[model samples]
Target: MSGVITGERRSADTHSARSGGGAFVPEATPLDDARAQLAVATGLLGYSDGLHAMLATPRRELTVAVPLRADDGSTMLFTGYRVQHNFSRGPAKGGLRYSPGVNLDEVRALAMWMTWKCALLDVPYGGAKGGVAIDPRLHSKAELERVTRRYTSEILPIIGPERDIPAPDVGTDEQTMAWMMDTYSVNTGYTVPGIVTGKPISLGGSQGRASATSRGVTHIALAALKHRGISASRASAAVQGFGKVGRDTARFLHQAGLRVLGISDQYGAIHNAGGLDIERLCAFVDETGTVMGFPGAEPLDRDLLLELDVDLLVPAAVEGVLHEGNATRVTAPVIVEGANGPTSPAAARIFADRGQLVVPDILANAGGVIVSYFEWVQANQAYWWNAAEVEAKLEERMLSAWQQVVDYATQRTLSLRTAATVLAVERVAEAHRLRGLYP
Candidate 1:
């Protein structure tokens, strides 16, 4: 087992997990962009500068140095962060990610987004996010577990069942949450399931937490398609970022009889004029860690895949994939952002001006947080809901939120993304006003 572990740990030596230049800004980070987004959104919503400025920044940020002893007998240090974007409504909730790209700025923006995502869905939780800057891909399960435990301990001071709860995000999942839940529980001397969301079902994870985001994305896509008068069954769909959100969104859409023409991941892309077999593709992804070499599909350049002519495009991976450069080339009539900030404001404007409908992240990807809320509720109540119950509630909420945004967009003649941002920011602002500022 130890030998198997060391072999897997050697894979990180190839540098596939490089986190795109987060060390460049030492102090104020890319998360500043999330604040900038709030600023822009507040401007759009007609909020005063003083109020927008307050919403732009995180309330608390904890930086911890996580030191781990690797199996190779080498000691390594990782930078970990927990940024709570807001805590007005209830306890903070979000995912903890382990990646080479984890940094204060990214975490801050993500946390801020969480604040709004929670508020938009009316979930009784605020927004928070944490991450450690390290490549988990190069480590074995034991090494990963050690890293997770240590990181959890480092952030232990601020996390709790009634405080800030953490779940799995990028490069983390149920096993990760399981470790988190155990670490917190072990120290507290009792099992406290509410301390985390997205845990293993045996430990109180929700029935559909894993696929909640994708399911929600599918619901948003269906809504967007309908609003635009595009029949989902006849629509050609392309999904970028074929991981948790992308793959599941594709799966749901495919199950709904949509022709998924193209899909891509960090490795590469696969294309089919008719429709690719998402089931086989998902199995291939599970076995190989990507969708690059799936049989019966021809490879296409990752950049070019986005330019493909399709009725719908889902950017389910990273942010800023659709910027000024490719936003104009977007041939899709409906752009459903399954990923956070996948389309920049300028690019979103290009699509909007072109009469394209974009379902923003706050609304489109609210499913994960919604399910996380369910998990949290089940944990606190000491009862778990069945998958059917979870899915039915999820669908009901997604549809209601969709209608709210659609009505607002229609009445104001605004873009869906704009309407969503406005709606989310307004709700948070209203909550803030109801509570009033604490002097």
Candidate 2:
């Protein structure tokens, strides 16, 4: 009964939702974009409507009320969601995020993307995602901890090491995971280190896990540049988000000899045509908590950063940053997505028409999940690998997946996104066929 939502019904439900301003925005939402992509891949793979519906619908969805007690003795109620998109290949695995924009549809899209990401990388995980509708920036550390614990407790019925594993995402990190692990452990009356990943090293987290996503993005970006006949030493990049993923991605790109010209955080963007000193900028951000007001670069408009005339543009921020409105203005010859779903369907069409190469998110930013799988394996085995070994394994996996996607894209004359999705969807669909349906 759970997977009964047909494609038509799903489309209707997705389109009916309105934005905060009471406008029936006609543009594609993240869920719409995700379903559209899947439809294309399924069509190419010769899948029937029944199997497409099975792939489109989430296997399970949970919504919970997360009430947190503030330090000021006030109660605030927040909504949280966890959507498990698929489970045919293996256990569900994804990240838990905290943001004001967190919603059921966004989580659903993210969970579906996670499924493809895992499958593309050959990791043993189905796609799942969890998020709370609260901004971590506005809350105190204690408040965030309370929110995480309460959210974890509410979703305890569905999450576990071998069932559904949560890692860090947008507004969440290792400390949040530590709290969730502690909450789950206290409830079960035993320690469950594998319940979550991205924890502190002291808590059995894998080495090199913190920067794994960024590392992976850098690897793919360099490869993409090379494929386009751009040398790393000559290429310039503009990273349009300096948060968890963007900050480290910029650093890695700079270290790899790319001239990182622009970087942006939520506050503002800064640019240096001659290339900014990434290490110095990092130190300044560490001291001031923003990329704005850095002595080494002049302030640039946040939106213009996306349109910069750079060789490589990494939109490592949030979803839909490179949508219809500004897709035409984006002049970057190559784009490597660091954030999930950064380029919408319309934007992708524009890029295709313009002959711009886009390295899709599932293939470009899978380093985190690849290493998360390693961490989970380590926890389950009660043994850990050193940083060198972990990174080597991650690089090997990332490069292998990149090569596979490139070859598939070239062979079929399809874009990388379509090729990656087709590869992942085919794998999941084959697994489902092998397992068959249960009465």
TM-score leader = 2
**lDDT of each prediction vs. the true structure?**
0.83, 0.91
Span of ten consecutive residues with least summed lDDT in model 2: 1-10
**Model 2 residue 318 lDDT?**
83
Please give the RMSD to the true structure for each candidate, in Å: 5.0, 5.6
Off by over 4 Å in 2: 1-26
Residue by residue across 1-439, what tens digits does model 2's lDDT show? 0111111212221233234454444567789999999999999999999999999999999999888788888778888899999999899999998877778998999999999999999999999999887777878999899989999999999999989999999889999999999999999999999999999999999999999999999999999999999999989999989988999999999999989999988888999999999999999999999999999699998878999999999999888777766778899999999999889898899999999999999999999999999999999999999999999999999999999999999999999999999999999999999998996
Query: What local lDDT does model 1 show for residue 87?
Result: 80
Best prediction by lDDT: 2
Give the Cα error of residue 301 in candidate 1, in Å: 0.4
Q: For model 1, how does the per-residue alpha-carbon lDDT over 417-439 read when each residue is reduced to its tens digit?
A: 66776788888888899999888
Residue 125 local lDDT, model 1:
83
* TM agreement with the true structure for every prediction: 0.92, 0.94
Screening candidate 2 with a backbone cut-off below 3 angstroms (N, C-alpha, C), the clashing residue pairs are none
Please give the lDDT score at residue 387 for candidate 1: 99
Q: Global CA lDDT of candidate 1, please?
A: 0.83
Q: Please give the lDDT score at residue 95 for candidate 1.
A: 87
